[model samples]
Target: MAKRELTPEEKARNGRNIALALGLIAFVVIVFITTIVRLGGNVVQRTF
Candidate 1:
């Protein structure tokens, strides 16, 4: 089967979607890291 070529508009939309997904992933990772760092000290010295 022959591969289909994407039109310019479709390509642009695809690129934008990929960028948006990556940005969301990065934001989530940053938030997770920040939360972990903020709580890391407390976690080590808990009594219970």
Candidate 2:
């Protein structure tokens, strides 16, 4: 089968999707880091 080229709208939608995914990933990373920092070293000292 031959590969088909993407139309302008498809390319734009793909770009937007990529940007949204990157933004979401960045947000999660930021939240994770903030949580870790707020928790500090005491997290390791907790007993079960």
Candidate 3:
């Protein structure tokens, strides 16, 4: 049996998809860290 091959256009599209996925993951991590910091700030409020 022979395996199917990917053309140059298909390869480029796959690479672009992977890059977009990584960018989205990075964005989510940044948002998560910012949310944690904001939440912690509220929890550690000072009483003056």
Q: What are the lDDT figures for the candidates, one per model?
A: 0.97, 0.97, 0.92
- Writing each residue's lDDT as its tens digit, candidate 2 over 1-48 gives 998999999999999999999999999999999999999987998888
CA deviation > 4 Å runs, candidate 2: none
Tens-digit lDDT track of model 1 for 1-48: 998999999999999999999999999999999999999989899899
lDDT of 3 by residue, 1-48 (tens): 898899999999999999999999999999999999878877668566
Name the regions of candidate 1 deviating beyond 4 angstroms. Answer: none
TM-score of 1: 0.88
Ranking by lDDT: 1, 2, 3
Between candidates 1 and 3, name the one with more favorable TM-score.
1
2 versus 3: better lDDT goes to: 2
